[model samples]
Target: MPQAAKRSNDVPGTAPNLVHPAVVNDDAVRTALAQHMSRISGSRTEITSFGRKSSGFSWITYAFAARSALGGDRKLILRVGPPSGLFAPYSVLPQVHALQALAGSGVPVPALVSSAQDGAEIGFPFFICEHIEGDVPAPWAASELDPNHKRVIARQFIEILASLHRINPDATPFASQAQGADRAELRAITGWRASLARPTARYYPLLDWGGRWLEDHCPLPPCRTVVHGDFRIGNFIEHKGRIVAILDWELTHLGDPHEDLAWAMMPTFNARSRKLYGVLERAEVIELYQRASGIAVSDRSLAFYEAYALYQAAAIQMCAVRAFEVDRFNDMRLAVMASQMPSIVRAFERALEAAA
Candidate 1:
């Protein structure tokens, strides 16, 4: 169980005196960065104005610029493990590997610069890449975009997901990373169940029951493909009404393609556009995906995964709350995450009942 939030180097909060020593202008990091950038564009440079902050749970993102010997500036983003501790067992290395494999595969992810697993240099594993510049409208503010643009972005989201699903699992580097004891179908079901088992009282009997249903009625001839464990509105970057880059690959893995589809369709993530789960109606998203990737998506399958997505999200939120309650790591944002669980659980239960 996650311990209650305590003052730790990893947790971020308003402690006036607590300057994060974990983040500093160190010589070794600067040297490594300079060398890495040298390889990219033959530029000998130094990291200038590196700033780090938590985007949410489990992520410490740094935005910085590199001044080249030629006096040009390149903006970059570095995503690293939190100083407190990671909320999930998965590593960022695989996300980088998957991104590398998908380069030119029609997926709309950020362009990768470099990734490192050697934790000694930065306290924990981290990856650096190009910083995508665009607007990510708050869920409530999604309406500010023109309705047609919203529809275009919505369709784009589904099509990009379909493109990822079409990637041959064996052709990707993360194939070994995804190797597990459970069969594909069982793996998908168990993964979500485990994610939700974090300490909390907002448990849903329907999710527990739905797990059994999924196990019993496994999809026919399972799809062994890459799954973006968390695919939602907040994860993408948009500019001029087009999705420029997909962010947050920390949860990428291999499983049924429907897993990604379901996550994208989760109601809690729908934000302001309640009319469409992820700002697009289920039918519209499905049609766009089918048209783009030439694959058939059944309504029944979408419904099953939709329920599973809610279960997965509720589990993540509960875990965040548990971290706060147990003093394992405390931040107001994480504590507030706990309060969202009841609504998430209620949504799942209603979906499960309607499906039944």
Candidate 2:
């Protein structure tokens, strides 16, 4: 297991100094983990493999191995919510309980070891989960997968989504997650609009115009499910040409199933091919989802959600814009995220007009 390297002025017998360019100090993290793990282990805990890892735009992650005299050793992943994360005001409760509820729902998520929102516990709300062994291919990268493998992966993606939709929400945290469908649509629009409503918002007239059109033309949700709000190619992990786990859940919520379908078809995920997410054409993808989930999808409802998904995408890009504008984070990724606004805006307008 990797440990932090020692600093010259450190205590005589502490772990080596952490020269891995970690965003947070390794010793501090070790101490926090020891304290937290002791509660479950009933003995002092040891943390190793304390290396920094950068996988996504939203959270700081540390990969580590832990052991205790009483509790066995394990490999784990830790996700910490930064105050100025890509999505601010972070809360892990919804995701934690949602994952808990989906334990047998056929959605392959990492096993949750523990979680907490108390800032004092781990600097910010944090959770530990099994370190899944899988690789996420770059969605924009050229195909290393043969045609057969690509088709299989594509089918698995939609099938997992269908399984998620079939899970009963009445007994889960998402039970009371929305008002009526119209209200929910309004809320989605309002929430995204708020991200760019500031005086400093880098506004484009089409963005505002598009928002209004979506509000005026809000259609009822086809049906509600626990929407994987960011469901797309890059968000899942693949092992042996199969999607082993659906990784990011920060945007998990209860909403229209169409939202996920439309979101997967977003421009960023579909750029490489005419197919949605580079796997299946729009009609074919929808066909698979409807067949697997046993729900008839309306073309009109899909058009509405397609436009809504683009609106949401543009607003999310604005989050990166605001963060970059104020230097909330120094990661060049924020700049990159903000840079996509022009193309995303164009895409949004095109989708909206096509719907009209």
Highest lDDT among the candidates is held by which one? 2
Please, what are the lDDT tens digits per residue for candidate 1 over residues 225-244?
77777788778888987888
The parts of candidate 2 lying over 4 Å away from their true place are 1-26, 177-182
TM-score of each: 0.81, 0.87
After TM-score superposition, the amount by which residue 145's alpha carbon in candidate 2 deviates from its true location, in angstroms, is: 2.8
lDDT of 2 at 241: 83
lDDT of 1: 0.68
Candidate 1 vs. true structure, TM-score: 0.81
